[model samples]
Target: MSEQSVTFRYRMSDRDVFYGGGVVNGARSITLANEAANRLMAKVFQNTGHCIEVRKVRLYEPCFAGDYMEFMARVRKMEGNRAVLEVRSFKIIEVPENPPYPSSIDVLPEPLLSTVVQFVYETY
Candidate 1:
């Protein structure tokens, strides 16, 4: 089968900040990647499969509250009922430092890559 891909987007909320300086927890980014992988699995297999293993989660940059995050998932390979997927998250927009107002936002010239996650899923 040809590879299938999916994308998911979310706006980081203040509640997502678990650490100081409005920084979001790394697990939150992993959760977003998993959600994207789940969507891809459901689209490709017509069922929501279980994630059997997470091969790796590489963090390239930090995510912050008020950042707009984009997650992309693509099938890497498939064998029988198991499939391997790779997910990446990028920051599309961010709250600028020392903004004039609290709600000010800036769109990045290019998406800032935040994380990459690879996992294996199995359909029942």
Candidate 2:
């Protein structure tokens, strides 16, 4: 079978929030990203007698509260039972609210959040 790439997007919710008084934490994003990447790999390797494992993961951007985050994964290199997959996370910021200043303010990292995960798959 030929190697293929898969992508998946997940919206940020109270459960995915990390720090800034959110339910989730920075490390939570890592777990979410890893799970998503594994799911994508499973879809691509279905019926191919292969397994997937993450090798490396890096966080580039921070997803803030009330923002939509998207994840994209692609198969970069494949050699025998091993394959490298790259995953990126993007945050969609929402429009600011108007009117009086709020008592509490939530701060988060700027720009989009990105993560690259490598996986190794073996066929039986």
Candidate 3:
């Protein structure tokens, strides 16, 4: 790979669920993506690196308790001492529930969160 990357899966549990519903908190979803970003930043941090901020963070769907989330991060661009990475979280492993379609047998869908994060390496 030309750019450093990482992928991992998380099983959302009751602790991560939001109030009044099985809905996973948006903050938890962001953290999921951030974990991946941290990996990429470490790979490029020959200098003192820190995540400046995340930009264009978007969530398309509600992740719920018992959903298996897949997280991935890849460098979108690196210029000078700054690197931008794209992070995404997807609901992969689903379960049986009130079936419009059988959740147990349904195919995993697209990403639920898409975000771009900028990491800066301080040169002194």
Candidate 4:
């Protein structure tokens, strides 16, 4: 299979938060990673890839509103039609008072969310 990947940067808006504060739902993080993985399926695997299972999941912290979220994915391993994917999630703390307007997406020393997913597929 061809190696296809993508990186996404997103700011959690009001719609992404429901706690009446800056806190974001965990589902959003998972969605970000899932979306990346799905995109790889179509782009690299030609729509023949499917996620047979989620091997593992880990949330290091809560994502708040105004925080920048970055999603990254790649095909870690492939055997026949099955592939293992590694998806990484990073959350950037937003500082409204920062010099660069609302926030910045500078790479930080850590991440708020990280996940790994397993996929199975058939490719021509």
Q: TM-score: which candidate is best?
A: 1
Give the lDDT ranking, best first.
1, 4, 3, 2
lDDT of 3 at 91: 75
lDDT by residue for model 2 over 1-124, one digit each (tens)?
2356565656566766657654346565666666655765677765334446667767665555555566666667768766566666666453234414543333335736555555555544
Compose the digit string of candidate 1's lDDT tens values, residues 51-124: 99999889999999999999999999887888889999999999999999988999999999999999999987
* lDDT of candidate model 4 versus the reference: 0.69
lDDT of 3 by residue, 4-121 (tens): 7778888888899886768778889788777777776666554336666566677776777778878888877766656667787777766556756643534466545533333332
Off by over 4 Å in 4: 1-4, 96-124
The Cα error of candidate 4 at residue 66, in Å, is 1.1
TM-score-better candidate, 3 vs 4: 3
Worst 10 residues of 1 by lDDT: 1-10
Reference-based TM-score, model 2: 0.65
Per-model TM against the reference: 0.95, 0.65, 0.75, 0.74
Ranking by TM-score: 1, 3, 4, 2
lDDT of 3 at 5: 74
Cα lDDT of candidate 3 equals: 0.67
Cα error of candidate 3 at position 80, Å = 1.7
